[model samples]
Target: MSKLDEKVGKYIDAVKDTCGLEPDVDLLRKVTAACGPVIYQRDAETVASSDPDEMDRVKKNFLMKKLGLSESDKLDEGIEAAIETYGRSERTKYRAVFYYLLTKHFGKDAVYGS
Candidate 1:
């Protein structure tokens, strides 16, 4: 399996263990599928940009918009936390989904590795 698959699998297992319930694989798949195109687009954008600052901006924008939090006052804070935890890479899609699931199951503190 690919590294991404391994990481995601481990994350799923951890979530299941923490929650004392099996994760909904269908839900995880759906989230991953929905986020894939956005991740690909961000990859393309990253390749097209030589400026690190511009790349960061593009990544943050993509995360906020794709996650449907564009109008949120805490958008920047959320994006910052995500970027810090996940980095600006295609794998971020999986990380975002993992964070979403973690927050849903265990709350925000769990998401930040608390």
Candidate 2:
């Protein structure tokens, strides 16, 4: 399996364990689609960047610090905290929303990768 697949699989497992629900990639994709642009625009504005690569780097740093994710951090806690802080409790699940911001932070190819 590709590294992206591995990461997704690990996160799927983490979500199942933490949230007691299965993660649907399709649903997650929809969530990403709905949220990605706005999140990127805002984050980019925060760092005053228009370049994708620069935005990605800055957003990555911001997310890690904001979400309290260290180098060894797993998806579960970070995602949960994000939902608590930034999500709509009625419609949000950490697993479904995180990939969008992550994609913005790593570039458009982040999900499937280059």
Candidate 3:
């Protein structure tokens, strides 16, 4: 398999193992693809949920800008739920998986398109 495919596989496993959610493989692949070369970088590959700036970026960039969500408490709640679902003890929270959870959380799979 290609490198990206391998990463997607790892992401699929992470979602299944971490959150116990049956991941949508196609959407996860798309989300991983959307993550681009960042997935290859060690530091940038995972999200640092403890960082205020990182959380802000997730809210503004991913949720608000990419998903076109309004700035509201619901956005924070969705993010928190995804983080909680992913496990607060888990250190390496893959960006694609996290985004996928958020997308699923908000019923914004349509944002990814069919």
Backbone clash total, candidate 3: 0
Assess the local accuracy of residue 77 in candidate 2 as a C-alpha lDDT between 0 and 100: 43
Candidate 3 positional error at 28, Å: 0.6
Per-prediction TM-score to the true structure, in the order listed: 0.35, 0.30, 0.97
Question: Which residues of candidate 2, in runs, are more than 4 Å off?
Answer: 29-82, 85-114
Least accurate stretch of 10 residues (summed lDDT) in model 2?
42-51
Top-TM-score candidate index: 3
State the lDDT of candidate 2 residue by residue for 1-114, as single tens digits. 854454455545544654455656654444434433343343421222224564354345544543334454444344344444333343322322454444333343333433
Q: What lDDT score is found at residue 109 in candidate 1?
A: 32
Candidate 1 lDDT by residue in tens digits, 13-101? 64455434565655554444444444344453122233557445544554344443345435445544544433344332344354454
Candidate 3, pairs of clashing residues = none
Residue-wise lDDT of candidate 3 within 1-82, one digit each (tens)? 9999999999999999988989899999988898899999999999999888999999999999989999999998998999
Runs in model 3 deviating more than 4 A are none
- State in Å the error of residue 61, model 1: 4.0
Best first by lDDT, ranked = 3, 1, 2
The segments of candidate 1 whose C-alpha lies over 4 angstroms from its true place after superposition are 1-8, 17-22, 37-59, 77-96, 102-114
